[model samples]
Target: MTRRSTGATTMPPAPTIPKIPPAEVLGRLAALQTLPTPALKEMWRQLFGREPLIFNRPYLQSRLAYRIQELAYGGLKPETRARLEALGEQLDGGNVVLRRIRADSRPLPGTRLVREYDGIQHVVTVRADDFEFEGRPYRSLSAIARHITGTRWNGWTFFGLKGRPEA
Candidate 1:
């Protein structure tokens, strides 16, 4: 075709959408699923104040869920991350994690604490002499601390409020 005096342009063809390999898709799902659902759910609640679930109303919720999950799994938050570091100083080789608030306040079952350290937050639950959620075994809080942070804690406690530790 010959060039015209007008500045009109032709539209480009639509971009093709590539299908994801089933193996790759399954691999990612497996990794995410490796972590306990309760822990993942707790992380979601702390970060987004909601459960880690794929919403399917209009498909928008699933998108949000993926974003939330991505943030939680990336790394610890700066606020809580520092706290975890400070716990080491106070405990002198003891693990000091930020404990969650309360049982009912907990986001899910089998979740003990949602502590923040070093600008990062973690949702953890431990039953004495048993293994932690991710297979980290602990005989005591100190052991749990070591297993979780590889250090000590000076300001570690269970989740509670001003009037209730068991609340």
Candidate 2:
């Protein structure tokens, strides 16, 4: 009986990144800020392993350059990172905060919200701290909605201010 052995192959070692001079690093970072939005986004993906949440060109460029510098010069100290995390948690309630649906939905003061319900046209004037409907000040749009419909309703929904809920 005879036995045969397969040959073993050696893999090449990973390439090493040369230490760039500080001046060159600064120059590179400066150059990054002039890149277009799409290019910056590509760089962001390469550096961060994910797409950027912001689409603004200047902001993207700045953040990507900062990230590049951070990687080369080392990141924040553990204590600084922990402090930042704690601050972020406090601001964000320890979870991902959803964008407000009504962030820009509210009408400016003196602007009017009009709705035709039950063959009657209702007009609501946006005020500094409250809404005015029929010369009556109301704290909430829901209150106005209740006044109009005699039932509990989301004022924004009733006035066609809110978009359809995502399924």
Candidate 3:
């Protein structure tokens, strides 16, 4: 395209990577699994420019294979990475510690939990940070379960939010 100000023509940017042969990529991927631990670690250092943190054989192999393919082909798009980061933030509220933990099974606020105990129905309303059972606030479902059954129980299992443990 020609620039109006400078009256000079310029070419568009070239592709970041050249297309690689499928067979070459496949051969490199297949070779990763057969490599010894030392060779794999060396390849990891060469590809990633850093020492492998985990040092697990399978992890090294898989990551090496992925790096090979990524170099041959391409990596994730910027938009995809941004979307993944946004999703992680939403799931953990940007808390690093919470991100490593499993997501809790708390129902959305205003959800009504219904359970029948001794032929009488019980209802618990889920709030943002607490629960309401019989118009009274409860810190945990287990507390409400203990109040009903007079015994300690897993709140999630008691209210059927989670599966019961097998004997």
Candidate 4:
């Protein structure tokens, strides 16, 4: 019996990143400012492994500079990330636009929130994406709160998920 080989396929090697000494990291960061926009974008692609959300040079340079240092050192700690999220929420003031932009702080589905307004008890059931109030679907707790109180409100505070922002 005889066998014939058609072809052999091989994957390309992954790009190897050269190690930069911690002290040289500062120089590398400074050099980023001198590179052209296209070069900077290519560097961003190489470092981040994805296209930047924004094409602004200053934004790219700042992020790339941080990434360079982060690679040599380390990124933010878990506690730092948590603290930033908390601060973001605090500053967000339950603004719907800001809420949509930042992290999702919604509670788990199947949770029930009870609040009394005008001497009547209101119940809201949390869903995966939206909420159910008075047997109707609502997009945000603020919307439900408005329906109940006839005024604007921060949904998280309204549901006791978060306390009212300090004045």
**Which has the greatest TM-score?**
3
TM-scores, one per candidate: 0.24, 0.41, 0.51, 0.45
Q: lDDT of all the models against the reference? A: 0.47, 0.75, 0.79, 0.81
Best by lDDT: 4
Residues 112-166 of candidate 1 have per-residue lDDT tens digits of 7666656667555744334253555554444545555776642145222233322
* Candidate 4, position 61, lDDT: 92
* Candidate 3, position 78, lDDT: 97
Instruction: Give model 3 RMSD, 1 decimal.
Output: 11.2
Q: Per-residue lDDT of 67-159 in model 4, one digit per residue for the tens?
A: 888888888999999997787667577475766544456665698999998999999998867899989999988999999999999888887
- Please identify model 3 stretches exceeding 4 Å from their true place: 1-22, 103-167
Clash statistics: count for each candidate: 29, 0, 0, 0
Give the clashing pairs for model 4: none
- Model 2 lDDT, residue 157, Cα: 87
